[model samples]
Target: MEYRVLLAESDRSMLERLCQVVDDTPNFTLAAKFQNVSDALGQGAVFNPNLILLDIEQPGGMGLVDAFKKVYPAASILCMGDKWQAESASGSIKAGAKGYIIKPFSGVELQESVDAFSRLGSDGSAEILVFFSPKGKSGKTTLIANLAMSLARKSGEPVGIIDADLQFGDMAVFFNLAAQTTIVEAVRDIRFLSPASLSSYYMPVAPNVSVLCGTRTPNMIDKVAIDKLENLIAMSRGLFRYILIDVPAGFNPTSIAAAEASNTTFLVSMINGAYEIDHMKRALHIFRDWEDMENRAKVIFTRVEPCDAQARLELSQKLGYPVTEIIPNDYAIVSDAADKGKMATDIRPDSPLSRQVDRLADNIIGRKHRIRWAGV
Candidate 1:
């Protein structure tokens, strides 16, 4: 199917060159091009393009990322900007960009971005996965680590895991590596980001798994704005088959923005505590109004002990939502693996807990397989 795309760039020469490239590509047609944010927003729902090419800095002093979301909900935006000014790329993704291409990028990068968006199903593929929890000690990091491993192993596709929990993130500790490059550094050079540059910033944990750890100091988090986080995820989407975000535990703007930017927001919780349950309920309430939640909010019950069966049932019943998956409490296995910087599934592939994780991975992949019945 042919895609009608809108291009918004302040550089006339660059815009024209990009247009020529798009024209050369099969299955894509330039529906329109705007020089500024005002013009693009004013056109509104009329151009009705399937994809958008947006500039980070446009006229009218308003961020192009913010305008695109309000103006074109159906169009998946691809953001572009200069390296120094590329900080706005993240903002664009938070505002709903499908992918981001930094300035000084090539036709190949542009084409690849377009192709990635095109392959998405009518339901909108989940190129980015954001996992968040409102309360601390809720096993957010572990979930992120395991889920990333699960996705990599099951899909046989590269997965990029970002520990967005800047202040207290322990993803590096879990991986047994000192974080050298972070999302902050990547955002600083947003303009230079391409498929090739992205690999340099990401620390490879496995053949198909890479991680971008958070800052060591809490103060460093201030350097990262909502837009940068969004842009980072957008760029990652183009590089990895899946981008999993491990968010800090809170309702801050950063967390909210991450939730908004994600294709699926996994609210991880445990069944033992009333505080966790109540917090999960409040989070659900908060997210129900979020623009992305119409089909994306999933409550995953983690660290489930066998004795907590009743509470789990009550929690599911009270929430009126199916628990997507119940990760059993296996502290010995989880802690040991985390300490050794190994994935639990890798260490205990035959364990029942690992089987549950495999099942979760299968469900996420949405595959169909035959089932045989001995007696029917």
Candidate 2:
């Protein structure tokens, strides 16, 4: 469809440049230009444009998108600014702006931005989930890596994983990916990034799964601030249907921030010794201070030797917190898959581990699932 563009900007030079770009681009006609948004909205109807290119760098400009929308219900209002800001983009989008773009951008860039915001699904925001463990080597990363693929396949929507373990993250290594951009860069650039633009930081690994890799080195953790990481995750809600975060073992600023942001956090552990139960009790005691700890913080024991309903019930009684899920040990295939940089489910579909992972995925999506094995 051809676009009749109405331009509104306070800067004359920028206005002229915008007019020129609109004039030169195909299927985009320069309908009218105004130095003030009030004049533009008051006299906008005479031109009858379908697209309103608004310069949002001006004071109170982002706030006026809804006013313009009320005036011209048919036109698409695209916000442009001197620099990108997450708050401004979120505010404008909430106020009915189609999308945001930075100044000195091309007609192609303008089109893509508008197209992206217009394509946002109306299914509400993403469901954020986090994986937390008392210590590392509890199979947290393995579960999350496989879950990304499972959720994407079952839900038929995009799935994203954030490796919040800045000091010792191995998400890229798990996927065998040489990520060009990591969470560190994303945080550094988040001040100038909008939801649509933030997609560049994530590397697509599977059909519908993508990952924001962690910091490149252990020391780089200092570069990733907690507040910035939260902003990164908040802006990313518009880009994916489900976001799974992997926090470093034990409690820290990063891990706490991730868990607090999530709708639910799985407190994962491995079946090693009786001391593991004591560790969980200590952790759960800390979680008791948080609201809704029982429902929001779930417990899962991996590599369970006896993964049965009876075993799960007995373990739940022992821990006080119900066992949400228990994954049986499938070491041989898992080792081989890890060696080859493949998911256990992908390589061994019939394996007990694969079946349990799929069932876990089922539980996550609120789908009714049944356990196949009667007894362990």
The TM-score values for the models, in the order shown, are: 0.68, 0.79
What is the C-alpha lDDT profile of model 2 across 12-117, one tens digit per residue?
9989998998888878899999999889989988999989988888877767887888888988887887776657656666777766667756777666555554
Best by lDDT: 2
lDDT of model number 1: 0.72
The models' CA-based lDDT, in order, is 0.72, 0.82
lDDT of 1 by residue, 1-376 (tens): 6678788888888888878877777777888877665777787458688788777655642366666777777677777766533345445545566666666556566666666555442222346778888787877688778878888888776778988887887888888878788878987776556744666798998878889988878899888888877777765665676788888887887788888787778888765656776788888888877665635787877777762447457657877765666788888999898778797888998766687777767766662122321111
RMSD of each: 8.1, 4.8
Report how far off residue 178 is in candidate 1 (Å).
Answer: 1.9
Best by TM-score: 2
